[model samples]
Target: MSTTTTAPATGTAGLPLADRTSGLVGSVIDSSTSLLAKQTHDIVRFAMGSPAADAIPTAALAEVARTALGVDRADAFDYAATEGDLPLREALVDMLADTTDATALDRVTITSGGMQGLDLACKLFVDPGDVVAVESPTYTNGSATALSYQADLLEIPVDEHGMDVEDLRGQAERTGKTPTVIYTVPTFQNPSGASLSLDRRHRLLALAREWGAVVIDDDPYGMLRFAGDPVPSLHELAAGDPLVFSVRTFSKIIAPGLRVGWVDTDPSLQPLLISAKQAMDTCTNLPAQRLVEGFLRGGYLAEHLARTRTAYRERKEAMQEALTEHFGGMARWTDPDGGFFLWITFDSPENNTEIDAAIDTEALFEVALAHGVAYIPGNAFSPSRRFPDALRVCFATTPPARIHEGVARLRRAVDELAGAAV
Candidate 1:
């Protein structure tokens, strides 16, 4: 049975909330936006995972907007097809022809964004109390979406190669239950910035097939590769397998505020996807769809991606250098070839018994903010609050100089915390 909520009476102080809403956990990642907005300090923001302020092609978008939403075309403002705008869909199919995630016309369905894609996947597959496998240090919002559907989460451990598939199989077997949905960011994962290796990707698919589960391939950052060789996407390897449901977005590669994304599924499932979408928001915003269509058709994305890749590469290197200079032996971090994040954790001494090296990152958040730096605590990424000593820092949004400043501030924050502890 679907859990539903009733709205409170207009004059009432409190309303009856829904049972499903109890699991509606908010995103710490998004909360930082409002938190930072009120600050009067000159903070070096490393909190939000976004493109650098100068990275957005404002001039190009503004130029396109004139024609994409021209006064001459009244239909530009009308309701689009639930599947997607026809022109945008066609352009997308052509645009992805040489990419790792190429798909046919029938398999494409436009969505509001990648978040809605995850929600749709859960709504279509997840049942109340069904096991849903997720990475331990997964994107909290994705796991929260599953939780909202009342699904029981099985937190699989993640490493440099992404989710440990062998461990997942063993854990699932021991539980005597199979997961209905397996969610993965796959390439350049959010928070951790780890890509699933090819071997593990194949293994994950095998397990999902054996268990009759759907693979929610939520890859928003695959195309932003500034380093390393390309790993084939789960959608490509699946090769028309209906079990793989791929969610992609222009939010990362283009502008996030646009909120335009698409889901690539088996052709047979397109109708269901359309129906599911129709019952949600009627249709995605038409003007945004048209703008993206203009961008793609004008041959601007390739140049835009190339330019940003170079900038992001420089930014990532800056963050790594800053970490080495400031953090040194006190902490360790992941060196991602692409994507926007670097996961940092404190190094604990082997002989130390009285004090664990793990600083409570959650407790340190306020201190870091006061010191004019910010990062999402590792516990925010985990549903079970694991890794209290770690946090995620975004390098894509800040410049090289600001990155150094932020890390220095973070180091000072740690010193302040230590001083207070003493």
Candidate 2:
């Protein structure tokens, strides 16, 4: 079941209720645009033509609801600390310690999600129009949020290992005023599906120090690693010396609806973030925090993560095989160690469409939708680059069977373009 509301005539314009909003929302049709509504059509999910619905762990969710309800529901209903309720904060501290420095406690703020956690970086560090170094094709949400704060988003190229350190150092030299922060997704990046090598991680932190800039490490997909040993978080590697905030999220692992995430960084920004947080939803839902805390305590999280890992790994395998079987010789994609995405890069010769056409790139988005499938184009994820033939396919939502069907449809679409060129 999906919710529905009348689409506003001028959504972004904010016209008077009585007046017609003739303003164009062309942004949604712009390849550079990032709209959660377009990216996630919760209002009309049935039109998506994908799986029935993501099966949430209802039993565990029920447990969480009941636990929070039972534990002084009146207090849980009250406003919580801007830093998040002390108990949830403590729980985060305990959970995050396994990944980073435990005693480096001064640098933790409970954010709504990795998205808000990243937004806090701009609020505290970046001034309007200030440049911020970002990996080319980093998460759009990060870039979009940065744009909202009026920062100049800089792009650094990424290889299989992740953000290029030499290019970053060169960019720093060119700017002379190192961006406020350098951001990267390190492991299991969004579209490229690349992970920063351990050496690159060390190199990045050192470059940030050299340029006198902070490192805004936004790593929501770190935990979903289906295979491979966990790398030390950027904060853990920096030893809390440089101004860095390691952002983590429980979305992919548990549920995005919960929106439980945290950022660990220097205490200098805490007061500012507390203020920004107050204006934005007043410390997140307190009762929600209590419920998530209960969920963590029940020991179901471990099993839940295990199940997610297994399921996603299988989905990844299915997508990988489909690409190989259906588009094998014609397409190339990076194999991720632990994440929900696989990026398909068609051979250049096979790509004839002049993506630079004045026409909005997002127009092609409707092509896939018409094909009874929906996916984010690569350009939206990487506005700073000419990555036209690339597309990101999420394996988290669709089941294995549909993964093949969707890829088959995509292959046909690509072939149609190739045939036109001939």
Best by TM-score: 1
Candidate lDDT (C-alpha), each: 0.88, 0.68
State every prediction's TM-score relative to the real structure: 0.95, 0.84
Give candidate 2's error at residue 181 in angstroms. Answer: 1.3
| Candidate 2 per-residue C-alpha lDDT over 1-422 given as tens digits, one digit per residue, 9 for 90 to 100 | 01111235643476464322221112222232333245553221112111124536768878778858675678888888888877877776666565544534556777787777877777777777778888887676676666666677778988888998898878777877567778788878876768888899999888778778888887777777787777777767888674677787777666777777888877877787889888886787776788777777777777877787787788889889888887765557888887767777666553524221222223434545555455666665664545665666777777788878887776555555444445
User: Model 1, range 151-248, lDDT digits (tens) per residue?
Assistant: 89999988999999998899999987689899998988888899999999999999999989999999999999999999999999999889999999
- Pairs that collide in candidate 1 are none
Candidate 2: residue 2 lDDT (0-100): 10
What lDDT is reached at residue 312 by model 1? 91
Measured with C-alpha atoms, the lDDT of residue 63 in candidate 1 is: 89
Candidate 2 yields a Cα-based lDDT of 0.68
The TM-score, computed over Cα atoms with residue i paired to residue i, of candidate 1 is 0.95
Clashes of each: 0, 3
